[model samples]
Target: MENKTTILSLFLIFLFTLPFSAQESYFPPEGEWETKEATAYQLDFAEAIEFAQDNEYSESRDLRQAILKGFQSEPYHKILGPTKKRGGPAGIIIKNGYIVAEWGDTERVDMTFSVTKSFLSTTALLALQQNLITDVNDKAGNYLWDDTFEGPHNSKITWKHLLEQNSDWSGELWGSYDWADRPPSDKNIDEWRERELHEPGTYFKYNDVRVNVLAYSLLNVFRKPLPKVLKEEIMDPIGASTKWRWYGYKDSWTTIDGLKMQSVSGGGHSGGGMFINTRDMARFGLLFMNNGKWEGNQLISEELIKEAVQPSKANTNYGYMWWLNADGPRQWENIDENIFYAAGFGGNFIIVDQKNNLVIVTRWLQPSKIEEFMQILYKNI
Candidate 1:
């Protein structure tokens, strides 16, 4: 009788702990993802699902038209790389690395504009981790040693400044001028061109030209295509699909070590960036939610991941190309400030809610409705 009682107690303990241990140990294998019913986790996400489905992005499914109409105010704006018709609203909500809910065609690949910046910033962090970049504060010119960073003000720009989008890197790359991108609406072309340049790290501006500079610099450091580095180092290890592709402008090619490689763009502002599926995007969010660890391997250093999300001096709502929920213009009210996300122009988002162990990936959602959607999702969580 005593032996039987001890056996019963052990069985009860095992039954209670089994689910949690399974949740912690499970990592999706290549070409496969695991799913769990929301009720199993005691989560009611019906309201959040309905909200997301109802609030689809109002832009045309034809993204080229949307891009042109959106950036018509900017002079010489043209689609320089590639653009494809986007699919309808899609998303996935992962809890404890298991898909608790998903909607639309999550496998459809689509262009993710500025969200590519976050990936671009990751490559730089990897370079730093590998000692290719001695320090973030070191002058960016020190690495490239070329005409791109030769001018008086341009020489002062650092990797951190570029990552923060405050580099004010004044130049042209792939035929796109620094002054022409999202220039001040209040100023004419000549006025915008001749405006006084702010010192790097002192001002924040979301200029794709400078972003491309960062991509180009990373190409020089890695001595290979950024896409190759990303695939081998991060994506494959996380079990992301092969459907994803990164692109650069048509003419954005350079010869390195006698081999020509394309330096990919940081966003699809002029039509080139990361083209990826929603499921893969969720996997990426899961990786970050786990603090840069995938399975048992630390793919990216936790220190770098923490630093990537830190508020920069120039913008409290901005990190190293990652958007923050800090008290700033872009803050999502009623949301936890610790949350950070990768955002793109066409309403694509990979929100990392580490506090709740949630990774939400939404594509083609109405840009303005994200805050409300997040609030509803948080309530459900």
Candidate 2:
């Protein structure tokens, strides 16, 4: 009787401790994550689904128009690359490492646009951890002595500056003129071209030309392709799908040490960046929400992520290629301030709410409706 009672007590204790222990150690396996209904989280998400459906972009709206407009602007040429048939109203929401909700063709790989910048920034962080380039604030000229970093203005650029999109690098790269990229609608071509250069770290501009310049500099720093670096360090460990592809323009190819290398773009702005499905993006976001740790392994240093999300002095809402929402004048209202996101063109977003242990990947959503979408998701939490 005593032995039986002891066994029963031990079993009860094990049952009591299971949830806590499991919660701390659980991680979805590669390509084999589990899913749960809204009820699993003890929340009604029916209204949330409706809210997401209602906020989706119109199918009839031409997404390529703005891209074409930018392409037809001054000093433009045919952008060389690939663009998949962009699907409509697709998203996936992961709660506590499980798929709580998914909509549209979640498996269809599509262009991720500037969301690639966050990935680009990750490579830089990894390089920092590996001590490849040492300090981010060190002048880019230290590693790159070519024309891209030799000019007085370009020489002042740093890895941090490039990551934050304030490098203001002045030059053409792979046929795209720096001044001609996404020029202000109000400014004439001459005004935009001759605009005074801002000191590297003092100004913020979301220019893809400069972003590509950063990619190029990173290529020189890594002494290899960025995708290979990401694959070995990030994607492979995260168990991301093999279908995703990073692309660069045809002319962007160059030879390095007798090896043919193509430096990928930081966006799909001129067509070519990360083409990944929602599931892989969810894994990437989950990695970040867990503070750069994965499956008990510190994939990226916590200190780097903290600094990565730190609002830049030049732009309060911008970090090291990550968009922040906490304490700025233009903060995302009605949502947790701790949330940060990787935003891209065509309304692709990876909203990371670490506070809730949630990662939401939305593609082709209406940009203006993102705040409301997040708010609705918050209510479900």
Output the number of the lDDT-best candidate. 1
CA lDDT of each candidate? 0.92, 0.84
Worst 10 residues of 2 by lDDT: 58-67
Cα lDDT for residue 36, model 2? Answer: 79
Model 2 residue 91 lDDT? 87
What lDDT, from 0 to 1, does candidate 2 have?
0.84
lDDT tens digits, residues 120-206, model 2? Answer: 899999999999879989988888757788777887888899999888888889998899887888989899888899998889998
Q: Which stretches of candidate 1 lie over 4 Å from their true place?
A: 1-25
Q: Any residue pairs clashing in model 2, and if so which?
A: none
Error of 1 at 190 (Å): 1.3
1-381: candidate 1 lDDT, tens digit per residue: 999999999998987886563547467898999899999989978898889899998978899999998899999999999998999999999988889999999999999999899999999989999999999999999999579899899989999999999989887899999999999889999999999999888899999999999999999999999999999999999989999999999999999999999999999999989999999999888888888988889989999999999999899999999999999988998999999999999799999988878899999899999999999988856
Minimal lDDT window, size 10, model 1: 18-27
